[model samples]
Target: MPLYAPSPALRGRQLAADVGLLAWLVLWVVVARTVHGAVLALAGPGRAVEDLGASVAGSMSSAAQAAADVPVVGDELAAPFEALGSAGGSVGGAGQAAQDAVGTLATVLAVVLVVLPVGWLLLRWLPWRLGWVRDAGVARRLATADPALLAARALATAPLTRLAALPPGTAEAWRAGDPTATRALAAVELARLGLPADTLGRDERRLGLR
Candidate 1:
């Protein structure tokens, strides 16, 4: 019985998700490491943190004094005045953190977008060129002055050509991962052609196959 399989779209989606997750994880690691390194550079070993407590306390006192000067205001106004400075500082810190996070994320995303297609292009071109070069080598090897030898070579190579010419299958064994079925089919074809069966044992050992 044939195995059940997911559609190409579903497989593509899964691949996309996996790639995205991997990208995100890599970005996070980079950001974290960068931040840690930056912090270490700024505050080396034996360095002390600058004290902000005195400045904050002074600002709170000033605010409280300003609130006290406001006419007709009760003691309740002092509480909000005291809290205002801390609240503003908290808001500023939160905003800065958000900005930093966004900047880091943008950089990561831009890098991914830029590098992805270049990587794909390299992958595409390298294999295509290699295949062309390989086939050229095969042609060179099959180059013979004798007409009978050429005809024999052609006949022997026909099965491999047929196998290469097979319409890419729709089955699970062909679409995403497993290639055993396609390979088996190719082997059957080679066997049918009665290709130098004694010289070759494995499917890969066949001439011009690798």
Candidate 2:
């Protein structure tokens, strides 16, 4: 059996849905970007640990330099103190590096935990939504439509090149339990563009639509 073609009102509703979804996405992207900035600021730049390392090394070196300036016993003490200063410096440097690493890790974590999931959702929805956008663009004429207009759309999407390529008019024939050529052609086109899958008998009672 031939498929149902939705009325123009239904088509309009779908077009609006596609457009609304796009607007929704624009809002979502703004939210995502704002959240990203917030996360980055909260995470910080890893400088505090680095500064602590530098401070510890500097203090130990200062003590060593003062102690090393004295006499024979001072010479031995000075060497040990110098070694201690070097160790402290190493510790400080390690702390700085560790903080740097932590900052890097936090950045990765934020992207994965926050942005990636949102990105994934956008990836999933956008393609389907874009398809609707394209379909709507092609079927825009359906907003102010007719049998001929719908038929024109059907031909645009499908492989059917000529009306002669399809079965004869179904609307005229449908009453006698057959379909008309005009509806048959339009239906095929609408089907290609993904329309009219659900139709009502005519509380839809309007003209120029299914």
Candidate 3:
């Protein structure tokens, strides 16, 4: 049920790691925003082109309207202006499409930049953190309910060097139901997990060793 190690040193390290992860995420988010802005800047030329096209279209449309009022050859003169205005409108449409494409590209790039690194880190980190929480919770419960189970787990999982640091024949003694050996082995496992000795309970006599 604990989110951190009972040991101050281990708990401090865990807290530091959590803080580092948060900082990393924030840093990448800022970077992504900056990149998005930079990429969006590429749309400036498209905006200029769209404005120029619109101006040309508007001018030609007005010219066409005026020329249609000419005395004799009005229709022939207005036809060319109308055609030029349609061409300008098409150019404006193309510019708008280019701006839309640039916007889409910028968004995609920014998302990929953040998602790849941050998501990769989260994928690696979240499972380990959650696994520790689950395992530590189980260990805490077993420490109270059946510390022998913890001792057995230590025998199976603890490094041989660590087991050797205990009294000679500690494993054999544990197999023989020696309460001291059981408590010692259990303590080894608890300490490995950064849990305190008292997690086995204040009264050693009440432990499941008997």
lDDT of each: 0.46, 0.57, 0.87
lDDT of 1 by residue, 48-121 (tens): 21124335545776888877787788456677767866665554555555546655665566566546654655
Winner by lDDT: 3
Lowest lDDT 10-residue stretch of candidate 2? 197-206
Cα RMSD to the true fold for all candidates: 16.1, 10.1, 2.0
Q: Which one is best on TM-score?
A: 3
Please give the distance, in angstroms, between residue 55's alpha carbon in candidate 2 and its true position after superposition: 4.1
lDDT of 2 by residue, 114-188 (tens): 556556666766676566657645454453344455655555566745545665554344334332444566566
Candidate 3: tens digits of C-alpha lDDT, residues 1-210: 678898898788778878878887998889989999999999998988898889889999999999999989999899999999999898888889999999999999989888898888889778877877888888888887888898999999999999989999999998998888988999999988888877886555676454
Deviation from native of the Cα of residue 71 in model 3, angstroms: 3.8
lDDT of 3: 0.87
Clashing pairs in 3: none
Q: Taking the candidates one at a time, how many backbone clashes does each contain?
A: 0, 13, 0
Error of 3 at 172 (Å): 1.2
